[model samples]
Target: MTGPTLLADLVDTSQRVGEHAGRRTKIARLADFLRRLSPEEIDIGVSYLAGVTRQGRSGIGYALIRDAQPAANVEVSELTLAEVDATLDQIAGASGRGSIADRTRLLSALFARATTREQEFLARLLLGELRQGALEGLMIEAVAAAADLPAANVRRAAMIAGGIASVASLALAEGAAGLSRFAIALFQPLAPMLAQPADDITDAMARIPMAALEWKLDGARVQVHKSGDDVRVYTRTGNDVTAAAPEIVSAVLRAQAQSLILDGEAIALKPNGAPYAFQDTMRRFGRMLDIEVMRATMPLSVFFFDCLHRDESDLVSTPAATRFEAMTAALPSELLIPRLVTSETSAAQAFYDDALGRGHEGVMVKALDAPYEPGARSATWLKVKRIHTLDLVVLAAEW
Candidate 1:
């Protein structure tokens, strides 16, 4: 049987990945490292290379990490991947009275066992300062290479599966068939589909003629999931903001569909129906305290643009026009964004101007037949904004 993988080995690979400037080289190193890990270690190993601990954040700040550091690192490395993960689990679970003391003791013990290089790696990993060139995209490529599967397959699975670490574990064990099990389910927030920027309305229309144009509000991008009476809201980055935005949850609960996933923006609107500034909207959206007071003071309004899932059907692979139709059938027209489908540039430009006049950022021009490409800045969806140039003098420099 293969022995446990060493933490030092992962640290060494991360160092090498950081040193390499070429993406292909970094991916190769990561893939090779991933292939060496046993099935159980795959998730933990992948999370590390992707610059996160398996236990997520443990409330250990930089000051705590600095104070917990051992005066000297061990001359020889004896830490295994399993050991490190176990220790981190303990740190994360350290709560209640005297939890700070417990966390400090655990961190100090772990640091003491680590070698010089291992200590450096651990410090950076805990503080989220691990700046290896291996980002999520590179790590996804590496997982695909290691598992001998198509990168697109891994990426899609990762999008639905929430994170690459779990998908990596599954892909390495069961390959393509295992990945096929992932689907858009209620309450599991899929990453929002991103758009590429277009120069102007004419350029956007030229790129995607007969496009669907919708107002791009300068507010928080939210994906709302609903199943019967249960409704949840997630930010663009896939954070569950359900508790933070009770108004959004209530709105989703009232939607016509029993099971639905709607993508759109949540903005604080003035009494006259114009949107507040982006920062003002965020202040209301991001707040978790005194929510009822904020909701009363600055009411949030949602405008749905696309429906990814409706009733029992998953429409991620469905065309844009079809998804919008589903959204229309499931949501009240007032809840839906103002949209116009047109091939005429002048007509599209008029819609764009109308959106700007209503205090939105600009407009998004999307191909009617384009399928939703989650987590990608797809060219099929183009954002057209009025650019303003300003002159400024640099009075201060820091570095």
Candidate 2:
């Protein structure tokens, strides 16, 4: 029988993946490494290569990591991937009283067994600084290449599976046939389809002359899942916020469908129906404590724009118009967002103006016949704003 895979092997593969410039070269190296991993190691190995830990954040920050580092690294590599993963599992499960010291002890013990290079990799992985360019997109390509399946097939499976690691595990194990098992289920949140920013309404209309335009409110994006009376809400990043948004849950429970997954925005509205600031909506959406007080003081309203699943049918690959029709049939008109489908640029411009006049951020121009591409900034969907906005990352900030 083959012995357990070494952490050094994964670290070496990650180094090679980072050193390569071409995407094909990166995918080739990643695919080779993925093929060599045993069945039990695929999920953990894939997540690490994709720049995340399987255990998620382990409460080990920079200070704690620094304090936990050994005075000297091990002379030789001895740690296996399973061993490292087990250590992280323990660290993540450590909580409540004496958790910090327990975490520090676990970190120290793990680091003490790792060599110099392995120590660097572990520190970076723990601190979320693992920027080797092996992001989810490239990893998806690698998984496809490794599994000998089309990239689109793997991507679609990843969309429904919520992450590439789990999809990779299945694809590598059972190939295309295993992927067929993935389907939209209640409470399992899929990544929200993203939109590319258009220069203006005219630009958007030019690209998609016949489009479905909906007001883009300055609010929190929420995906609600319901089965019978059980309802759950997830944020854009798939964090469960059901407990924080009881009003949203109650509203979803009242919907006509027995099982449904609806994507929309949640905004805190004034008594007269004007939306509060984005931060205010987020404050209510992100809160876990004093929810009743917050809900009473600043109530949130939801407006559905797309339906992904209804009862036993999966509508992810359904045309936008059909999905909208399904949403309309299942939800009250007040629960759906205001939308207008038209080919005329003049009508589209008027709708855009009205959305801005109502204090929304802008409008989304989506192709009526196009299917939703989850987690993708698809050209089929474009966002038009009155003023162009640029997002910047601060390298250095001085007061």
Candidate 3:
């Protein structure tokens, strides 16, 4: 496959990207490398450029990498991308009993074969410290350039597709038309839409004249996908948390619609029907081992605020008002986040105060007609918090 490109090639490209002062040079270098990747190499190549492992994580710490003794006889271009990827996959997948030692041995073997430069690159790649200036944004630009597609189209497709690697492969192979096929699907997650922070309720309400004020709880953001008997819950970063939150699964199954994607938050509750502290909720959120046992004590609740898909139709393009309406129709009151629709500044302020009084973080003011813009933080959604933050200057630091 295309002369079996070496790990040295990518490392060399990354070095050049960082060394170049001009942005165009960095973009061009990355684009040239991206053009050489085959279909199977897209995910691995993209992950490397983004300073992460395609295998999620290597479970290799700095100490482990530090302990890996370097080799005497250097072979710079001997390690192929696929070969390195296979070794990393083994290390990441290692588990049970002596898995750590097994991983250590495997890592040692790889390090022993790697040249000094390749070993240094491997350490950075494993530690996610690839300080090579070209982050995912630049990677996206390079992908766009290599595929001969508009950057915006590539970005939008990447957002919907959930990963740039797949989008890149498609774009390179099928061009712009391939990227257009990405749509809202069950079990897959697009990056969650984020909001801007508002100084006060008045300013927040001013931004969206007729707005919807939803009680913003200090809880884990969830995107629920339900299709017939199948149900999945994902965190904001797209980690599946379905097994940890069973009540959420039941709630989705009871939803009126057969297939839909509902976005909301999951908060733990106390016996008194009040939400627990944010930290307390997190403990419950992260507990997968004794979830059933802990569910009885620190039971969690789901609150649906936005509907991304419904009745086999993608509603992300629809206005907030329409999506909220769909969410209302689908979710029972017990699972719905408390929301107030108003144009009055007084009402917005009152809602914000009431939310804080009820032990919530803040209130989210959303423009009624604003469409959900995934992977973006815009003024369409504003958070009005009770406590204000001060940006302090750091004049000195001590180690």
Give the winner by TM-score: 2
- Judge candidate 3 against the unseen true structure and give its global Cα lDDT, from 0 to 1: 0.85
Q: Per-residue lDDT of 1-399 in model 1, one digit per residue for the tens?
A: 269999989998999999989989999999999989999899889998888988887988877887787877889989999999999999999989999989999999999999978988888888788899877889999999999999999998887776798699889888998788777778778888899999999889888988999999889999999888988899987899998889888777777888999999999999998888889999999999999999999988998999999998999899999999999888878899999999999999899999988878899999999988777779999998879899999997532
For candidate 2, which ten residues in a row score worst on lDDT?
390-399
Each prediction's Cα RMSD? Answer: 4.0, 3.4, 4.1
After superposition, the stretches of candidate 3 with alpha carbons farther than 4 Å from their true spots are 71-75, 196-211, 237-244, 279-298, 341-347, 377-399
| TM-score of each candidate structure, all chains considered together | 0.81, 0.86, 0.84
lDDT of 2 by residue, 142-205 (tens): 9999999999999998987777997988899999898987767788888899999999888999
Query: How do the residues 1-399 of candidate 3 rate in per-residue lDDT, one tens digit apiece?
Result: 277778888888889999998888988998899889887777688778878777766678866775665556276559878888999888988999988888888888888778889888888888877899888778888999989889888887877876676688888888878887786778888789999998888888777899999999999999999999999999998999899999889888999998989889999977666789889999999888988898888888999899999987899889999998898898788888899999999988888888888888899999989988887787899988777579999997532
Against the hidden true structure, what lDDT does model 2 obtain? Answer: 0.91
Name the lDDT of candidate 1. Answer: 0.89
* Ranked by lDDT, top first: 2, 1, 3
Worst 10 residues of 3 by lDDT: 68-77
Name the best candidate (by lDDT): 2
